[model samples]
Every structure is written in C-alpha cells, then in structure tokens.
Target: MPQTLFDKLWAPHVVADLGDDWALLHVDRVLLHDMSGARALTEVGERGYSLARPDLVFATPDHAVSSAPGRSSATFAGGARPIERLRQRVRETGIRLFDLGQPGHGIVHVMAPELAIVLPGTTLVCGDSHTCTNGGVGALAFGIGASELTHVLATQTLMQRRPRTMRLTFTGTLPPGVTAKDMILAAIGQLGTAGGTGFAVEYAGEAVRALPLEARLTLCNLSIEMGAKMGFCAPDDVTFAYLKGRRFAPTGAAWDAAVAAWRTLRSDDGAVFDREVAIDAGTIAPQITWGTSPEQVAPVTANVPYPAGPADQAALDYIGLAAGQALIGTPVDWVFIGSCTNSRLSDLRDAAAVLRGRKVAPHVTAWVVPGSETVKREAEAEGLHAQFLEAGFEWREPGCALCVCVNGESVPAGKRSVSTSNRNFVGRQGTGARTHLASPAMAAAAALAGAIVDVRSY
Candidate 1:
C-alpha cells in the first residue's frame, strides 16, 4: 500500500488499535514547562504512580519566566511560585531540566529542535498548545491537556485517534519579504481557522522545499492556528544538516544509520492524501491579521473587510477596527517581535535588517525578544542587537515575552500593536490591548512608521 509521509512516520508509532479510530501511540519525547507541567507532575505523585520513563522527559521554565535581562525567579513579580514548583517537580521525578541561566534553557519548542532533542520520525508531546512547533523537525508532535499530561507522564504513551492527512503544496517562488509567516497566514486567511480540523498537514512542493530550516519551523509553528493537529515537512539533506552537529543528534555510525532511515521517511510517489490544497507562492504578500482570529487576515496593502455578520462585527469591535477601514497607516502604539512562533535567530535577523539605519517612530514602544539564550548570544555576536538598539527597539532575554500576559509583560489596555506572535485572540498580549499580527519585517515596518505599513515599502 502506498503511504503519505504522515503514514510513514505515524504508523510505526501505533502500538495497538483500540477500535473507534483510537490507537495506543508510543511517545518518544515529553516536554514540560513551568506553568502546566508542575501541576501535572504533582497530580501524578499524588496518585502514587511512578514515572514510566523519566529519562525520556524534559523540563524547562519558559512560559512564566521573566524575559528581562538580569532576571531571577524573584525578578519577575509573582513568578517565583511557578519556577520553584517546576524545580521541585523536576527533582521529584529525577528528570533532566533546562534551568534558567543555563545554555540549554529556552522556550521548550525552540530548545527541542535546536538541541536535536526532537528527531525525525518520532512522536513528541508537550503540555503547551504550540507543541506542534516541534513538528517542524518532522516529528509527530502535538499538545496535550492536563489530564492527558498525567497519563503520558505515568505511561510514556497516549491514546489518540488517527487523523486524516492533508497535503498543501506551494508552487513557484516566494517574493522577497513574503516569508513563511506570510505563507501560513495567507493559508489560514483562505481556509479560515478551522479548515484543518481532524487532519495532520504535510507541507510540500518547491517553495516548502526551498525554505531554510528556521523558516520551516515558522511554518509548522502556526499549524495549530489553522486547526491542524500537527504539521511537518519531510526530512531531507537540509534537515539532516541542521541536526548534524547538535548535542542530542546521533553521531558517527549512528548518524549514518539515522540519516539512512530518514531518507526513506518521505511519502511514496503514488501516495494519496485525504485532502489536498495547492498555493501559488507568488500570490502571497506580507500578511496582517485584521480581526482577532488569525483567519481574519489581509494583505498589507488591502483594507479591512467589511463585517458580514454579528460575529464579524464583534471581532471588529474587539480589535478596534471599523468595517472596510484601511490597515495601512493605522496608528500603532507597540511593536513586539518575538514568540515561540517567530523568535528564532533568523526572525531577529530579518527584523534587524529592516531596522538598520532607520529609527523607530517616537511614539511606538518596540521590543525584540530572542527565543533562546543561544539565539540571543548568536545575534549579539553578529551585531544584530546593535541595529535594533540603534533603531529604538529593546533587546530582551529569551522566553515567551509579550506573547502571553502570564509573565506580567504586556501591552497597555486601549493600545494597538503590531506583533509577530502566533495568536491574536482578545487579551492575548494583555487586557483590552488590540493586537495586529504580522511577520517580523512587517512588525519592524510598523514600528518605524508608527502605523501599519507594507514592508515592501521599506
């Protein structure tokens, strides 16, 4: 039987068919963060169950940690509780933890791939919803809830229903400034937020193949926004090269075996997917989210759509946009260029490139947070920080800064901002703050113009 890339990776993980479309899937890696993971671990201890495989689990403090340089657990107001709790849980389970100030410590999604902790043709699970970000490395990664986390903790396996496979092939070449962020946002705009429900998406075709490893990560990071259970790109030389020298990657003869195995992990030529969509890369432009939902997107040059229903009207109201209003020249009070979705070194470099020799508008408060300490170090080494600092953007330490309101970093209420984070739901950045989602370059353009402007204009 011919099989899709998804089938090639997933079928091997199924331990047993439990009927009703469910299967017992063996999970290769389990990642945990401070906020939800601490609680899940506590529940497992309370239930008197031993961890089935503590060596396979990894822990980090990301979500609730302060991204402020010189920050301690105590430096972030009200952050000590979760950090201490995570440390305690990690100690109890005897699992490895990437603690604050350590080189390996970072946003779970970012660290996993950079360290080669997430390998191709494996299953990875995390308590965070954006766990799908790890799927960028060609793993069958997905997010699980608290109860599900407890189950995985106790047994290193999960019960999940098989998902239909969807293939989205991007043809032609992408124009400069039309990034992976733009590509995913454009797909969501055309397909709506719920379009990929009940499906795992396999991104393919010329454009996808041509993407750098980091950009491929950006594409898969937003798969959740399109309602995908997970998303992945088939492994090839680019994938192997990125993983080759990483700490956790297999070495020597083991490396040869791993690469040989990965080469066969792609879909057979005659394989068929349950659903298929094709996108012309040339047609995609720099995208901006107009309403709260990621699907409510428009090209930077386009006007906001006129509301077609009460739901649309409500989204417009919450986001402070009027029907048919233009997004260009719309005033912005803040600009954030960071998140697990787009906070890697390449993302920072792209934003810094736009800010070089240009000052941010006096009224806009702009920030650039690195995704990991390693990325921060690399960017600073390459003088990327100086460009941002000279352009009036704050260069912060790594963590999920300003992406969610949990760490007390927030955009003030009634303010409008351009951000590169994944979600723009109401109150995602802070209470009552209106978020306009865009690529890092687009965010940089907005920071300079003090209003939404096309990056192509810069």
Candidate 2:
C-alpha cells in the first residue's frame, strides 16, 4: 500500500464510513485542558450524558493558569475561579489530571508526550488547536471545537472526515540560530493559513530527524494554522528516550514492547502521499509575523511586506505599521516566551542564553514561563530564572499567563508584543494587542533590544 503516516493512524480508528466522506472513528485518547474541559463538561451535563471511558481521558490546567516564574501552584491565586473548579471536577470524576501544583502540571501538549500518554498508533483529541503538538510522538492528534469536545466527553467516539495526506520533506541543516519555531513559522508563511485544509501533514527528511523531540512538537504544533485536522511525525528513539522516565510512561517489559511496536510507525520505503512540499533548511531565515495572520510574515532580517492594490487595510492600519518597514529594528512594547507551543525547559534555556548577562530593555515588559511544574522546577534549579530576573524581566508563576488573555493576563491593548505563543490573529493575545510571533530566541532578542531583532547576531 502506498500509505502515508496519516493513513496508517486513521485506518485503525474507523468504525464505519458514511456516504460522501464522514466516518465514525474510535478515539483512544481524549485530552482536554482546564478551561475547555470545564466548558465541555458543563455542556455534557446540560444534556445529561456521562463519559463512557473516563480512564482514557486526561485533563490538565495549563491555558488559564499562570506559568509565571517561581509560581509553585497550578491554579493561579488571583486568576479565574471557575477554571479551578473545573480542574477539581476532573479530579472528582477520578480523571487522572496533572492538576495545579502537581509535578507534571503544565501545557497539556508538552505534558502528555513527556508522560508518554501520546504514543505510536494512537488517536488524541483536545479542545486546543495546538493539540497537533503531540503528533511528534507519531500519534494522530488534532483539535476539536467545543461541540465536538462535548461529544467526546459524552461518548468516547467522534464523527470525522478523513483528511488528505501531505508530506513535507526537509533537506540540509538549519542555521545555528534557527529553532523549531522558525521552521513552523516558515511553513505557515509558505503555505498560508488555509493551505493545508483537509490535509494531515507528515514531516520528513534529515531536517526533521535532526530536531529534538520538543522541537518536533513545536513544528507540528502549528499544523492547525495550515488548516490540518491532524498532524504527526514518525516515532523514533528520541521520542522513546524522552518518554522513558515520565510519570505515566510504560515501565519494565511493557516499555520494551511499546518501543518495539513504535518502530514500525513510519512510512515505508516508496510510500506515497496525496501532496508533497519540499523545503531547503539553509535558506529558511528566523521568522516572525508582521500582521494579523500567521502567514503575514517576513524573515527577521527582512521588512514587513507591503500589500498590493486592495486588501485588509484594517489590519494594516491597526498594527500602525506602514508598508515596507524593516522588522529587525521595529520597536516593541512587550516580549513573552513560554506557551504550550514553546514552553519547555529547552526553550527557556535558549532564551536564557541570549539574556544571560544582558539586561532587558528599560521599556520592555518581558516574561518567561515554563510549560509544566517539572519544567518550572528544572529551570529554577539551573538558574534560568535568576538570569531572567537579573535581566529585569518580571518572573511569573507557572501557568499559561499572557499566552492568551484568557485569565486577564493580557498585554494592554495597542502595545506591540513579540510573543513565543503560536497564533497572532487579531485580539489573540488581547483585543488590539499587536502580536508579533517569534521563537523564544527571537522573543528574548526583542526583549533585550526593545524591538523585533534577528536573534542570530545575539
């Protein structure tokens, strides 16, 4: 069979095929974050339905919580109360939750794979778009709307249409300063936000294999931005090694068996894909968005592109950025690093390397957040926290603070922020907050320079 990775993952879950395109798919894992779970649980209760397999589901408090530096709690002290009530609900339901203040508490995407909850030949769903982030472990992972979330909560199955298969092949080595974030941002810019609609993208070639598992997660995290329902990579040794010691990982003989099964998760030689895209790693520059869409991006060393003839002038005017201005020296009001997309300890270490001895610019309000409680503790033990604070950055507790304005932790409107989070859509960070998405390194560079600047030189 000329099957792609997506085909391999999707075929196993098919329960029945409906005329035209829909099918009933059996879901193996239902992963939901704090806020989305609460909403879905409420909706499920409103309709009087019970979860069929609570044990197969996992919930965590990440998005609405604060991942601020030095914060020991999972639920923020001053944040949304309803969110915590929901985390309690997950626990009350006997759902295994990485609750606030727990060792593994952090972004669900980062936490799931680290615990080995997302393994080969599994189907995972979450309410968050970046659920695709887990695809790095060779699982079929995707996001769903609140309605689909409620359905999954009610009955561990979902009605879905199979997505087309797309293969992205990367060759050569990335430059020293480029990170996974740069690769994904470049992908989004190349394909446009809607490019991968109805497709599942499988990343391959030397460039992908060269990335660390966490970096691969960052690469798959933005698959939704390209309109994919799901995305994944092949399971390999890097995935197994990172998963070996996590709390929920398989142990002893089970671990050996699991690894043995995972070895066959990749596309076989001569396997075919519905679509293919090729990228040369050497030419890709450090990337950042200039406008409302993730696709409206330019190289860090390039200028904000000018739109031709007639276009969304509203977005252009709102950013207060005239056409053709170089992004390298553009001033910024805030800088944020630490989101589900790039909040791992490695991400913190990369940013810290840039700010090690340099002070943050006087006018920049900068913050660093670790993805999980374990990540928070690890970074603190290594003095990454001290370096950031010494640089005049505000060290916050662990939660998804400012990753979005969900918890009132927003950058004040009209202020431009260079962020490490995924989306830069209008009002995504906060209403009217001009968001320029970049890698942790680039965000760190912006914080120190008080503007969007190429991180390579630093």
Candidate 3:
C-alpha cells in the first residue's frame, strides 16, 4: 500500500487501535521545559507514578530563565520559583535537566534538535506549541497539554487521533532576500490561519529541500500558527548530513543502518493526500505580519491592507496601524533576533551580515539572543557576537527571551517591535506591545533603519 510520509511515521508508532482513528501511540522522545515541567512532574509524583521511560525524557529551563548575559536562575525573579522546582523534580526523577549555563540548555525545541535528541522518523511531544518545530527533522512531533504531559511521563504512550494529511509543495527557486520565514509566512497568508486545521502538513518540493536544516526548522516552527499541530519535511541527504555527527545521533555502523532506514521514510510514489497546496517560491517576498495573526501578512514592499471585516479592523487598531499605510518606514522601537523559531547560529549570522559596518538606530533597542548555549559559543567563536555588539545590539545568553515575554525581557507597552519570533499576537511580547514578525535579516534591517525596511535594500 502506498503511504505518505506522515503515514509511514505514524503507523510504526501505533501501539494499539483505540477506535475511531484514535490509537495508543508510543512516544519516542519527551521534552519538558521550565514553564510546565515542574507542575507536570509534581502531578506524576502526587499520583504515585514513576517515569515509564526516564531515558527518553529530557528537561530544560528556558521559558522561565533570564536570557540576560551572565544571568542565573535567580536573575529573573518571576522565574526563580519555577526554575528551582524544575531542578528539584528532575533531581528526584532522574530525568536529565539541562540546567542554566549548561551546554545543552536552551529552548526545549532548539536544544532537542541541536543535540540530535529528536531524530528522523520518531515520535516526540513537548509541553510547547512550537514542539512542532522538531518536525524539521521529519519527526512526528506535536505539543501536548498539561494532562498529556503527565500521561506521557507515566507511560511512554499517548492517546491520539490520526490527523489527515496535507502536502504543501513550494516549487521554483526563492528570490534574493526571500527566505524560509517568508515562504511559510506567505503560505499562511494565502491559506489563512485555519487552512491546515486537523491536518498534518508535509512541506516538500525544490524550495523546501533547498533550505538548510536550521532553515527547515524555522519553516516548521510556524506550523502551529497556521493551525496545524504537526508539519515536517521528509529526510534526505541534507537531513542526513546535518545529523551525521551530532551528539545522540547514531554513530559508526549504526549511522549507516539508520540512514539506510531513513531513506525509506519518504512518501511512496502515487500516495494520496487529503489535501494538497502548491506555492510558487518566486512569488514570496520578505514578509511581515501587519496585524495580530500570522495570516495578516504582506510583502515588505506592501502596505497595511484595508480591513475586510471587524476582525481585520480590530487587528489594525491593536497594532496602531491604518489601512493602506505603508509598512516600510514605519517606526520601530525594538528589534528582537531570538526565539526557538529563529535564534540558531545561521539566524545570528544572517542578522550579523546585515548589521556589519552599520549601526542600530539610536531610537531602536536591539537584542540578539542565541537559541542555545552551543549556538552562543559558536557565534562568538566566529565573531558574530562582535558584529552585533559593535552594531549596538545586546548580545545575550540563550533562552526563549522576549518571544514568550516572561523571562525578564519584553518590549514595553504600546511600543512597536520587529521580531524574528513566530507569533505577533497582542501581548505576546508584553501587555499592549505591538509586534511585527519577520526574518532575522529583516529584523536587523529594521533595527538599523529604526523602522521597518526592505532587507533587500540593505
């Protein structure tokens, strides 16, 4: 029988059929973060349950830890309690907790892939919506609620209904300054936020395959914003090359065997999908979200669109923008270049390239937080941090930072920001903060210009 990539990844993980498309699916990897890990671990202990597969569980403190340079767990007063509790529970349960300043410490989604903990053709779940970010490695990954986290800890399986399949193929080459961020944002703009509801999307075609592994992660990170729980790219040579020497990845003969098996993880010819969408990569430009939702986006050269309904009007009102106003030259007060979505080494390099021989505008406060401690070290080794610091951007430690807005970093109320993070929803960065989502290069350009500007022009 012909099967899609999702079908191949889903079938082998099914432990039992639970009727009506629901099944007991064995989970291959479990990631826990500071925001919810402590509570979930406490609940499991309260219920007198032991971790079914402690070896498969990895915990990290990212959401609640400060990203401030030289920050400790106590640096963020609001996060101190959660960080301490997470440390305690992990100690008791023997789950590996990548503590603050640790080499593997980072946003859960970022470090997991960086460490090769979430591999191709595995099932992973984290207590984070952006857990879908791991799907870049072709894993069947998704976010789970609090209860589901507890359940997964007590038993290495989850009760889940199989999602229908959707294939989004991006044909043609991307134009200069267009990126994976723009590609995904363009898809969401064309398909709307709810277009992928109830479907697991597979991103394929020339453009997707051309993206580097880190770029693919950025592409899949926004899957949740498009109303999909899971999105993935089939593993190919690019995937294999990226994983070949990473820690936790198979080594020696095992690696050869793993690659041999991974090669067969793609969709079989003639396989059918529940839905299919094709996008021309050449048509996508550097995109920025004009309103609250990811779908409320336009090319950087475009203007704020006229409202089609009350919802559109409300978004514009919240963002403090008028219909038909040009996005370019709009004043920006903050620029953030970090998040699980876009804080990798490559993202830093991209931003640094734009800031080289330039300076951030005096009115713009810019920050560059690496995705992980490893990324931080690598970037510094390459003098990327020097470029950003010389250009007037704060070079901070690795963590969620302003993307989650609870880690002692935030854009002030009513201020406009150009951010590389996934979402631009109201209050996502802080109460009443207005965020325009873009790529790292675009965010850097905004910081230099003190407003939104075309990266291409820079």
For candidate 3, lDDT tens digit of each residue in 107-179? 8989999999999999999999999999999999999999999999999999999999999999999998888
lDDT by residue (tens digit), candidate 1, 1-458: 88999998888998899999899999999999988889989988899888889989988888887888788877786779988998998888899999887887888899999989999998999988789888777889999899999999998899999999999899999999999999999999988889998899999989999999989999999999999969999988999999999988999999999999999988889899999999999999999999888999999999989987988889999988887778898999999999988899999988988876999999999999898888889899999999999999998888887998688799999899899999899899999999999999999999999999999977
TM-score of each: 0.98, 0.95, 0.99
RMSD of each: 1.0, 2.1, 0.8
The models' CA-based lDDT, in order, is: 0.91, 0.83, 0.94
Evaluate residue 109 in candidate 2 and report its C-alpha lDDT on the 0 to 100 scale: 86
Ranking by lDDT: 3, 1, 2
Q: Give the range of the ten consecutive residues with the poorest summed lDDT in model 3.
A: 348-357
**Candidate 3 TM-score, C-alpha based:** 0.99
lDDT of 2 at 44: 81
Identify the runs in model 2 with alpha carbons over 4 angstroms from their true place: 19-21, 66-79
Worst 10 residues of 1 by lDDT: 69-78
The deviation in Å at residue 1 for candidate 3 is 2.2
Model 2 lDDT on a 0 to 1 scale: 0.83
